[model samples]
Target: MSDLRQAARAAGTGGNGARRRPAFIITIDVEEDDAWSGSATVATRNAAFLPRFQALCDRYGLPPTYLVDWTMATSPAFQEFGRAVLERGRGEIGMHLHAWTTPPILPLTGADHRHKPFLTDYPEHVMAAKVTTATRVLEDTFQIAPVSHRAGRWMLDETYARILVEHGYLADCSVTPHISWRGTSGAPGGRGPKDYTGFPEKPYFVDPEALHRAGGSPLLEVPMTIAVRRYGAVVERARALLSRSGPARRASGRLWPATTWMRPNGRNRRDMIELARRALHSGRDHVEFMLHSSELMPGGSPYFRTFRSVEALYDDIEALFAFASGPFEGLTLSGYRARFAADAGRPPESAAGPRRTG
Candidate 1:
């Protein structure tokens, strides 16, 4: 184990010196089926899997945080389902911004042509407008103001974080630690944040100007759990080397043993479980798991193109839940934040300056 892992493990004890049980937040990026295509038209998306996804959550007694985007937020059927989830006290609704479809579509001018649906890439004014429109749509449709957000494409930055604070959002789950999407084909034209190479895997309060570093800012950054095992340093070096080229970076992400970002679908179950076990052993209090809602239905996502594939995904999720139930208490994003705040004896709000409108 690396020094950081060793230190984290040693620190994973309660105030009384006993090992603290791990907790987890299962977040779903609830959006349109065409999200990956970058051609997502508002009218072309369907949230057909929401009901089934909610049923799975109900079955496992897990309260998931649905980070909905403009498409899902505006769908009456989706809203009805969300209402039921809220009524049953089974889930929390949060914002997931897909800048392209979020409205007030900024004109493609100058660097705007490089737009990648990542809110952070836009001008501050454009970003603010898009965020405002999306948040308002979600509030108006759901009749509840959301306090948590997840940026589309995992492309959040300091500006986005500050905007989130201004909008009264208290938690963000957009950071994927130890990974940087820059130069990858996934982030077209190589315009994405290049700095997450050394971010802490555990949750921490964000410092707007230096998001990777922990500080006293009120906005809680609950990053998705990504753990690199025995060859962590070696993997980091290789990723850094490959990141210089777009094709190389994309290939590196597909390379196994280079690293693992916990996801429930497909071949990730074993890595997810193994990473969770490591986090538990290291004294980390929580693991944030995420997947796209479209992945829940056949023909919705590439990962689940068939009915059998979809069923297999569910089986994998259930198996992970079974393994984690005893070692980790599952909570929604907001629930985890509240618990973390209470444990730290701090108020739920940010301790930094007043929330400013962007």
Candidate 2:
């Protein structure tokens, strides 16, 4: 916590021009339309809804990095769409691993089978294999190696970070600040992942062993943009602190399940816009926005059940995108990583080649 505090305070001093142009990055988790069901079987039906969503991104010139899982990797339609986006230089296809679906499937007890196990629970060897296999699938499907990632459940650990770097990834956006998965539903035995309560609100080169601190690893952990309108800095910091405590987090969730996060949930467009505004005004270099592709199709997600609601979400995103795209330059996740490196006077984060175009 003290280190994160120090890092948060040390934000602007690191780079010369890093503060000159703040960026807004968009990422979508492309996966099966299971609607949070932890089942291993994948239907990939919801991918049909992505074309329209991509159209919206095109209109606003907001390039998105589609964080694909194994299911989306195998979908022919998604593959064609991803290739087209990549060829056009308008989007990136990156990996997103759902531990349960990306095989070498592990043997799990009945309880574990029912509950989605975070990669934090996987044996280091199994994690290595799953990640390698998933990465290979994306490479084969897209003919390009992916360099950006987000764990399926926001469940990241040092082991996962190490695996990502070994496989040539440059940035991972899995940490959600002012929130924690502690005591949340997870692996077979008991409670959830370690608390991310103290990670800095901005991107930092992660210490390979301890994810929360700044270090020399090439894999920069771009923490998700999470801020709520109603909660000020002090109040939100308190929420993050309390989230670290077992009884407090449980009670708070029970009493107010929806009190946290400014991720684009479409519940209120103004709230997200204001938070983005605040980030820009504060001179932060990058703001990363994320959403799951499953949420686009009606009935594919619990929060959005009707076509009307989905359309409303589209409208809200348009308004927010219009506002964000104007002042803040839009960058893909990897592109923003390059910006960070350049700001630090380091070489561009290496990719397989300049993204190939026909």
Candidate 3:
């Protein structure tokens, strides 16, 4: 292990043979309901699930970070719920930019504009403008400057890192660890980013020159906890072989049981606990749990299409929290950032090495 990893492990465990405490974070992508479908419209949005989500947080004492997109930020109902959460001191508001719905909506001119809304595919200036608009709206609506951001579709790059830093964001949770959205076929009209197949699963400072690489960058990249099992290499090989064939890839996805990621509604108690154990053992101090607020409402999301499914999702979350009670302490995104800053002896905003200039 690297010195940084070793030091982090030692600090987490105290290195005195005492058991180490695991740390976990819950992050919700607060956005419109039409996320899966490319039909992102202002009129088809809802924030009705916020109350139930807040109640769940209160029940578990989990202070989650709600990464609100432009639609959610602009919705009066969502704003009211966000205000309630803030007033109750149970959550933090962060920025989540859905480039398509965000302001400065450019005219559909090319494949990039017509297809999926990958922020990196847009011009750096356009991306910056969208980010600026979204950030300003979120800050204005919540009455607090957002310190963290997560790009829609996990489509972040070095330009995004620079923009985030320019906007005073301290952390980003857009990287879904152990997985890549690159070259993956999206809905009939969309395209994803280029390959990020070898990105690290652990949280680290983004390398400014190569956003996929880990290094000393001002922004902390907190990837979602997506652990692959022992057959990860096999799964990768199969995936690569079937990359060009959609049907084959779909078949492989169904047959691949070893490729597991921790999702509230998708992962079982055993898988989540095992993933958490592996993360803690690998010297990781935090395991991030992510979900969409739309999933909390029946029919709001495909994952939870019914009230029963929503209750079941909650059951899964409750089970994971209960299982983690002994080893993991739940924290909000801002709370984790504060703790990380205290441990690093400086703020994340000042932790980057010299910026690369061309």
Candidate 4:
């Protein structure tokens, strides 16, 4: 705990007297429609709806980072829209790897994602190949080496973070704070997915392994904003500690953690607003909101099943933007990483964004 506190202070999360407005970042997973189905036959009709969502972000000057997957990268519809957005400087493009759908598919000892549904289930080399291939496709499609990422199926781990560092990615938005995909099948016979319980809400360089701990890696982790209401800070710290104790974890089921995400899907605007308020009060440096592109089109995602529900999501998004427009500065994922660097008294990565040198 002490080591993490020191690492965080050095990373510029806090300890300095200077105060900065918390940043807000929206990261949308741009993948094929009905992605949950894990169908090999790719479809991305949902790409047609990005401009509509971008228009809404434009209304609030919030440029989102569209995390493009292999399917979206190849979709002519998405290429057209993504090109226009980049040309107009309306948004940024980053990588989102869906292991089952991404190329260089290797047969694993266990079930494929259709049955197992975990990217960490595959070997590191397999994921490495998928990531390398995906990066090339995105660069060819958008003409910029993506510096940001969010792993598919929330399967971020030591291996995934190391892969990002190897590829020159500047930041990853895959860690869901206080959440654990533990006990889920992973790496065939290896350990389950990483547990992000007690992960920092603020961006920080991760450790060599155990991403939950602060380490010296340059690949910054921008954890998705998940908030708890009562005893917010205490609960967060305690949850982290409890994550390791078997007895405590068993007791936690009855303790009511009451976690909430800033996402618009299946949530209300007021709760989002309150979470933002609490985050600000806690001196958090950023708030991240994530949603899937499939949620934009009617009947594309299960969370948003109808046109009316999708519209309601838009309304919720508009209200969040309306609230955030005043107090927080909005940035794309890579854009915010640059800002965080500068705020920490380091040089900005670049006007466009940073590329990995190592």
> What is residue 270's positional error in candidate 4, in angstroms?
1.2
Residue 234, model 2, lDDT: 74
Q: What is candidate 1's TM-score against the reference? A: 0.84
Stretches of candidate 1 off by over 4 Å are 1-20, 43-46, 109-115, 185-191, 231-257, 348-358
User: Per-residue lDDT of 141-208 in model 1, one digit per residue for the tens?
Assistant: 77877888898887887888888888878789988877877644322433455557788777888888
- Please name the candidate that would achieve the greatest TM-score relative to the true structure: 2
**Of candidates 4 and 3, the better by TM-score:** 3
User: lDDT of each prediction vs. the true structure?
Assistant: 0.75, 0.77, 0.72, 0.78
Question: What is the TM-score of candidate 3?
Answer: 0.83
Candidates ranked by TM-score: 2, 1, 3, 4
Off by over 4 Å in 2: 1-20, 38-40, 111-113, 228-262, 348-358
Instruction: Return the TM-score for candidate 2, rounded to 2 decimals.
Output: 0.85
Candidate 3 residue lDDT tens string, 249-346: 78767666545667765446678767766665676788887888788878887778888888888888877766554456678776776666656566
Worst 10 residues of 2 by lDDT: 349-358
